[model samples]
Target: MNKLLVITVLVALLALSAESFRMPRQAEEDQGTLTKITDAVKTYYTDAVNTVSGYVDSVKGLQLEEKAKTLYTDTTNVMSTYAGILQDQLYHIFYHN
Candidate 1:
C-alpha cells in the first residue's frame, strides 16, 4: 500500500511537470507569430514610403522641366527680336545712304 501511494505521487508530479514544460513551447509559438506580423507591417510601410518618395521626385522633375522650357522659349524670343532689329538697321544704312 505504501508503494502504491509513492507511485501515484510520482505520476502526479510527472504530469504536472510535463504540463509546465508544454506551456513554454506554446508561449514561444505565440511570440514567433507576433514577430512575423510585425515584420510584415514594417515591410508594407517601407514599400509605401518608397513609392511615395518616387512619385514626389517624379513630380519635381516634371516641374523643373517645365521651368526650363519656359526659360528657353523666352531666350529664343529675345534673340529673334534682336536679330530683326539689327537687320532693319543694316537695311536702312545701306539703302538710305
Candidate 2:
C-alpha cells in the first residue's frame, strides 16, 4: 500500500513538471495580446486623426503647404523631368517623326 501511494505521488509530480514546460497558459498570453491590441487601436486612431486633419486642411487649400513644398520639391522635380522626357518621346513618335 505504501509503495502504491508513493508511485501515485511520483506520477503526479512528473505530470506537473511536464505541464510546467508546456505552452503558455491562456491567461498569461491574453495580457500580452490585449496590450498589442490596445497599441494597435491607438495607432489606428492617431492615423485616422491625422487623415481627418489633412482633409480639413484641404478644404482651405492649405494642407500644410510650406511643409509639403519643402518635402516634395525634389520628388516633384524628378517627376516633372520624367514626364517631360516621356512627352518628348511621344511627340517624336506621333508628330515630329
Candidate 3:
C-alpha cells in the first residue's frame, strides 16, 4: 500500500512538472529528469518486491520435518537440563541433610 502510494505521488509530480511554466527546452529537460527518476524508483521497488517474495517462498518451502526435529531437540535439551538442576537441589536438601 505504501509503495503504491509513493509511485502514485511520483507519477503525479511528473505530470505536474511536465506542465511547468518554464521555457519549452527547460520543460522537456525537466520531463526527462522526472521520467528518469520515476523509472529508477520503479526498478528499485520491483527488485525489492521480488527479493522479499523469494524469501517468503523459500521459507514456505522448508521441510516441516526439519523444523519439527529442531524444535524437538531444543525442547528435550531444555527439559533435561532443568531436570538435572532440580535433582541436584533435591539431593542436597533431602540426602545431604
Q: Considering only N, C-alpha and C atoms within 3 Å, which residue pairs clash in candidate 3?
A: none
> TM-score rank, highest first?
3, 1, 2
> Which has the greatest lDDT?
3
Candidate scoring better on TM-score of 1 and 2: 1
> In model 1, what are the clashing residue pairs, if there are any?
none
Estimate the overall C-alpha local distance difference test score of candidate 3.
0.81
RMSD in Å for model 3 = 7.4
Q: What is the C-alpha lDDT of each candidate?
A: 0.75, 0.71, 0.81
- Over the stretch 1-97, how does candidate 2's per-residue lDDT look in tens digits? 9989967865654454342446765554455544555556558769999999998978668647776787799899999999999999999999973
| Candidate 3 local lDDT, 2-86, one digit each (tens) | 9899878987966854644565455444556667777787798899999999998888798777999999999999999999999
Q: What is the TM-score of each candidate against the true structure?
A: 0.39, 0.32, 0.44
- Runs in model 2 deviating more than 4 A are 1-31, 62-97
After superposition, candidate 1 runs with Cα above 4 Å error = 1-62
Q: Highest TM-score, which number?
A: 3
Candidate 2 residue pairs in clash (backbone atoms < 3 Å): none
lDDT order of candidates, top first: 3, 1, 2
> Regarding TM-score, does 2 or 3 come out ahead?
3
